[model samples]
Target: MPYDFNQQIIQEFRANRGKVGGPFEGARLLLLTTTGARSGVRRTVPLGYLNDEGGRMLVIASAGGAPHHPAWYHNLRADPRVTVETGVFTVEAEAAVLEGEERERLFARAVEADSGWADYQARSGRVLPVVALTPRSVSFPDLPEGASPPLHADRLDATLVPATSDDRAAVMAAIRSLLAGAPALGADVTPALAHTGGVPGVWVSAAGGSATGDGVTLYVHGGGFEHTQPALEPLMACRLSEATRRPAFKVEQRLAPVHPYPAALDDVVAVYRSLLEQGVPSDRVIVCGESSGGTLVLSALLALKEAGDPLPGAAVAISPLTDLTLSSRSLDVDDGRDVISRRVAEHVTAQYLAGAPADQAPQSPLHGDLSGLPPLLLVAGTAEVLLDDTRRFAAAASAAGAEVTLDLYEGMPHAFHASVMAQDPPAVAMTFLRRLADWVAGSRARGRRGC
Candidate 1:
């Protein structure tokens, strides 16, 4: 195709949101943008694509059988980072050149799907290269087309206190079983080591995320306040960055039995203050964390409010441990049904608290005043032992005059959103991310930058 011809099609496609008229009208296609391997200049070209069931876009580099691989192919071979405009939205993707059995199988399938691929291969006298573009972010709609947020989410009616018949050994057994199946969700992230407010951590970006952006999503990982998943934390942070559409700083806070009580909490607050000092608007920033990380998020809010510091626009806690007291009833009622029993909770709380009073405000965020805080999105599963931790926190935050949105997934275990880390994740996990995206947008719309 002539340079002028490709330019016209690009203009038409952009104007029509992925559609082109004349010979290409209504064809399934996407705009592929690749960096010139040598010159480092970006080039965009429209290509016919096939939807692979593994969540990848398949493009054949036949180049009309011209006996040489396409320029884009060589460009991607040098640098796999590519930008794809699917007309739904633009996202960053990593280009993987298919090879061996996977290549033969997909190429065969492409031929079966369209004889044009076979015709091109025959004319080229060389095997066509098949490339798969796996999006670095998990994109989802705000709820399914027919779905809607419930008007009210009533608390689960199960008993809070434990029964004498509950066996400790049985509870431990159940905890181990449930914890074993916890989804290891995460993304392919690029991380750079940095210190925010003198607190050491990594700035992470989802594979295709932009680090040069102004706003940031501050992410704190969950590890029961004592342990850390060094290898997996970056992956999780990457996903959060993608979900919120911002570069993320994954805090490496001090752990328990060593840097107990207020150490970790202080780290979160310090990093937040660093963002504000660096000129990132409070409203443009998002503080999101999971498990104990979520606990720190809420605690940080209370601390910030007490000190008259600015708060982020919004927050999301994915199954946080709000009460170090371990007094939530679901710890007993949902005991064996979920992972991590009362014993584990007690050990974690004792270690992190290290003689700090559990009834105090920041230590036990569930005990503090939650008034004048930013909009919050709390997610949990009904099958988790911390169900009540989520339930009680939502109830208290709402009662304390804070904005709250509790998204519950029934029959899901603790930290269920971790499942979204997989290449092809379950619907529930995608829904969690979609809901977060919508909630974040809504928070920005209302300008809920906290005081």
Candidate 2:
């Protein structure tokens, strides 16, 4: 592990797309560049890596079993920001060193993958450091060239029927009409009377047959905090059911402006609890939502954890509003490209908070303890104002040692996944849903395998 020899390997790695000959041939290697803690200079080191269950790249500070910690580890501690190069792609990532039980578990997995790590740990005597390279931004390589402009720009001239506090009935009617107008992508919708702990909801499943399993998806629909329409639930539920090959329970939780703060949170938690009470194992359940509903999905997980309830296998949030404080930088930067403006976001937040602290945990989950939550998949569009909400939440969750995957679609608007059937080229949206479904299914399978 001499400096001159390391530099030779680094040169070989760069020349060979992260591959090198001799002892490191066919090894999984990545180039980590960190700013020096003292000198503030960029330092690059080639290291081996292991992909964790959360899809994060794990790099060990073995330093070839040196007595002292690696210099790059010190740099990362001083500044978490780091650049990662794997093969031909380079990504900006935040480096987080795992600790205690989480560190032990990941280290064991690494040792299992490669026994050399155990020898490194034995020789070092020090706890071998494990660093998670959590991506800050993901690039979409498959995006079509010469694609259409942003979706919101084309619809800007369309009629704007504002949903107001005074016109609650009008808002409900408008939401129903919008849902009714959406093209049904071939899903069997059935009404469920007094489902989910006496809360009414809809059951969306595939058309061919009834979905049979303890595994179910509890879906909460998004309409800021004011609007809750049964019509909107099935559109996404059917797709979810089709994707996961399980029944989707679309919960009609109480909305804001009337049943503020804990009411909606309580109702969603009740539905989740009811599923557990009805013989559905916690690991077989997956909670999912969008927009404000996405907020609820995260909040419910926090509440469930607080109550000592068994957590679900996984959860999905699409364009979720994680911060009611409206403090994300993207809110101002991406405002014009999104459908929800600052004025609308502020009004919705006020209605939802209703005198409650805006930064309260389980209300605005961004401020909550994200440690014990289930594996999460967050999907958002680059142009959406709430894009930062998703990104920040994902980062926090990952930092807290929770499994999280964030997918950002280029040039799409807020909740654009809902526009799967409406867009001219629905390829991106379709791909997103398919990936979500695959994640859910895979998570369930992993649970069955005791991972």
Candidate 3:
């Protein structure tokens, strides 16, 4: 009903797609992010806008009848590239300053719509500026034939297992035994903090590694977005930390059917932002996750990008559920072939979205603009129900001008990379680790953008 601060209103607007309560309720409002002319930093402000010709939107530099134009007006004039988050779509647009009769006609139209523009113009003494934001065409990249993972020789054989296990807990236990079966924690990583972070997680480091130096690994665990394995995730993090040479924070994000949609994603973002706030460099941080956690890693990147935050050095998504709508055709084609079925996917998505639109983002990372993200490594198995989900995302991200490495393990089922968790991990698992470590090392060697 009432708002105290701009950030408070902004939080509500972002959470509700630019909607706010009280006087601004039902008003034509949008959040605008522009590069500051003087500071060379991005500044986001909430503003009202009007529709224009050819689908362009007009935003006026009224400054609420102030003596000077708003800082955003100066910022946009210096850098015409602006990001507008309208309820309908969040997009990048080129801001064109209207002049002469065009500005007159638009100002007249705006005054007719609200009468406030005229008041602001009369009160300010100078003519107000009307900038038209025209969205540019985005060319998404298509993956080449070689970009797809090579099919495993035993791929069809891996599909013969039960489509879906009835004893879900038992299935989980079996997986835990296979993945985190103790297997003697290495002497290099003998010490591990039982818990850590702004979010619930475990702090694990190798003997040779720095706890708060160089880089940090933010590891998010997967559980179909409903289940959380507090006991097992640390071991997973240990595996990652050992492989990456970075102390890993294994995030225990909130689960669904209770705290759904943004709760888990919000936890992830908070943890990452907290790390940055603590003086950790963004280019040195690596965000990695598995299954739904992988989904969050990508989603958090999108959210952070939208908020004008710096991205990480690189990211890894192992068997990610990129599309929450579960529209991937592989879900049906690999129904009985993969370990999980279409029904399981539906339940996970329904509980996680909890009435949020599945087709939209940052709930569905694949649905969001993928540009400006850090280098990404997407690992999946050909036998997975989410094969296409991961593949399609890689293609899209690549097209969106992000560096992406799509690693496919032939014939391996969902989360085949977890084989690295096994005692005396299989060759495939070791191969995955070798590539992972190499990729991460390579990311560090390159510039923040992987140049």
Predict model 3's lDDT versus the native.
0.73
Residue runs of model 2 more than 4 Å from their true location after superposition: 1-180, 190-194, 207-214, 421-425, 445-451
List the candidates' TM-scores in order.
0.58, 0.62, 0.60
Residue 408 C-alpha lDDT in model 2: 63
- What's the count of clashing pairs in each model shown? 2, 0, 3
Candidate 1 weakest lDDT stretch, 10 residues: 155-164
Q: What is the C-alpha lDDT of each candidate?
A: 0.73, 0.73, 0.73
Of models 2 and 3, which has the larger TM-score?
A: 2
Which 10 consecutive positions of candidate 2 have the poorest summed lDDT? Answer: 154-163
**Candidate 1 local distance difference test against the native:** 0.73
At residue 405, give the lDDT of candidate 3: 69
Q: Which candidate is the best by TM-score?
A: 2
Please give, for residues 1-451, the per-residue lDDT of candidate 3 as tens digits: 1234667777888665445897788676777889989989987888888866554778999888888988888998899998776532344679999999999998899999898788999999989999998764211112232133222211101111111132223333445666444555553433233223457766777525654465678899998999976656676787788778877877879899899989999999888887877777787788999999999999999999999998887888998998888888678867886778889999999999989999998999989998778888888775679987887787677666677666666456787666566565656666678777877776667644421
lDDT for model 2: 0.73
Alpha carbon deviation, residue 186, candidate 2 (Å): 4.0
